[model samples]
Target: MALSVIGAGFGRTGTLSLKFALEQLGLSPCHHMMEVFANPEQAPVWLSAARGETVDWDSLLSGYKASVDWPSCHFWRELAAHYPEAKVILSTRDPQQWYKSISGTIFPAMAGGLPEEGPQRDMLTMVRHIVSDKVFSGATDQAHVLDVLARHEAEVKRSIPAERLLVFDVAESWEPLCRFLGVPVPDTPFPRTNSSEEFQARLS
Candidate 1:
């Protein structure tokens, strides 16, 4: 299935919640970094893309109805171009809070020194290459990271047409997202998940 939504948000920006929210809105099978861990074979494809290799976007994301978080987020431009009809969602949060979330969760996990010879390691390496090296330029300073975040948000806002892009914050909940996607809000509450504590626990 073609992607109906392309998430240009970095990981830890409530992306996990957004994944569940989109799925509930009928955009099921949303891809996230967790998907790469679950489907090991997909790692090399993303790794290749991270290394600037050509990839078949359609085949790479064949079963996903939407995509979010890292790996996919890193390739938003390509995905948006490939799936012209797909709407882009730039998920964001307070830059300071976002840095805290990542520094405590993903950054530590990436630096946790997990075994170097497994699917998880491969996935982490790919994320490091795309997010750390490419996006943040191997710098972890608060100022630098926040600058990258701001710059990315600005770039997305400038690049995508107003009608085709939604700058979303998961905290805003259902209404805007529902309206943007032309879907009714669900009867249940929006998903709130994968907090820093939860992410830390998973790594342990």
Candidate 2:
């Protein structure tokens, strides 16, 4: 399908659950960060694209009908321009809650897991700078967290077309999401996976 959907939301913002939900809504085979992990060999190709090096968009997104999370969110503005018919879903949550989640799960993974001196490293750093604090180095307080959330909200609103953009709160579950995708609601609540505690336990 030519109809691309970009989930330009940070981690701990329901990106994974949305991936499954979108697939259920017929946009199968979505690209996500976890997929990148599963196929670490493909890191170079994606890293090149993230670095603003030219790439065949269609070829890069070979089987993906949609994409969610980190690197995807980073390139959303460009993706929207490339695919005019695409939909952009900015997943969100309470700023404080999001801050807690990131401090507890995401930042630790990024800082310790990803390398700091290669294409993948540069790409990840770029996304982190755009989405979170580049200077603070894992600081998540009331002011900084709110700042991140607000900036994310503002930038997405200003950059994307109204008709194509949907600000989604995962707490609301499947109704709004299904409606946005023009699909019937499934007989299921959104699946929650990868909790903050779970992430910590896995990494530890």
Candidate 3:
């Protein structure tokens, strides 16, 4: 299936919640980093992409209707171009809060104990190449990270047509998202999940 929605946001920006929200909106089986973990075969593909190699996007994401978070989000431009009809969602949050969330959740986790070989290691290395190395330039300083996010948000805005993009914060819940995607707001509450506390708990 072609991707109907492309998440252009970095990780730790309510991406997990957005994944579930999109699924509930009928974009079921949304692809996220979690999908990569569950599908180890995908790690090599992503690692290739991280190293500037080309792969068939259609085959790689064949069954996914939407994708959020990393690995995919890093390829938003290519995906958007490949699937010209797809809408882009630029998920965002307060800079300070975003930095704090990643510091506690993603940064440490990436640096923590990881398998020495195989798919898990490939995934972690791919993540490092994409986020820590490329995006942040190997700097985790608050000011630099915030600047990168601001520039990334601006780049997405400039690259995508205004009508085709939604600068979303999950805290805003369903209204703007539903309106952007032209889907009815569901009766159930929006998903709220994968908080820093939850992430830390998972590591323990």
Candidate 4:
């Protein structure tokens, strides 16, 4: 099935929670970085995409109803073009808070070295190329990273049509998201997950 939602948010921006929320709202099988780790066979396809090679987005993302976080976020423009009917969610937060979350979680994960071979290393390499090299220019300084974050949010706002785009913060709860997607808000509370400490534990 085609993507119903395209999340143009970086990691640590409540993407994991979004993934879960989407599933709760019947957008099951949402794609995220965790999907890559779960399906090692998908690594090469993404690595090729990271290298600027042509990719069959349909073939790569088949079966997923929504996509978020890295890898997908890196290709959000293309996805938005491809799935014109899909709603784009630009999940965001205060720049400093966003930087702090990633610094304590995703940044360290990217900086942590891996073995020279294997799917995990390959996936990390692809992430580095897209996130570190392309997005951050291999810089980890807080100010620089926050600047990049601001620029990305601004770019998303400028690029996507206002009607189809929703600038969201997970803290806003489910009303806006459900309204944007024309779906009813679930009776349950919003999924709160993947905190900095939890992320570190997962890596460890």
TM-score list, all predictions: 0.97, 0.83, 0.97, 0.97
lDDT of 1 by residue, 1-204 (tens): 899999999998999999999999989999999998899889889989988899999899998999999989999999999999999999999888999999988777767565659887778788888888899998988999999999999999999999999999999999999999998888899999999988988877
Candidate with better lDDT, 2 vs 4? 4
lDDT of 1 at 8: 98
Task: List the candidate 1 regions with Cα displacement exceeding 4 Å.
Answer: 112-114
Q: All models: lDDT? A: 0.92, 0.75, 0.92, 0.91
TM-score of 4: 0.97
* Ten-residue region with minimum lDDT total, candidate 1: 107-116
Q: At residue 7, what lDDT does model 4 achieve? A: 96
Candidate 3 regions exceeding 4 Å error are 112-114
**For candidate 2, what is the lDDT?**
0.75
lDDT of 3 by residue, 1-204 (tens): 899999999999999999999999999899999998899799889878877898899999999999999989999999999999999999999989999999888888778666889887888888888888878898888999899999999999999999999999999999999999998999999999999998899769
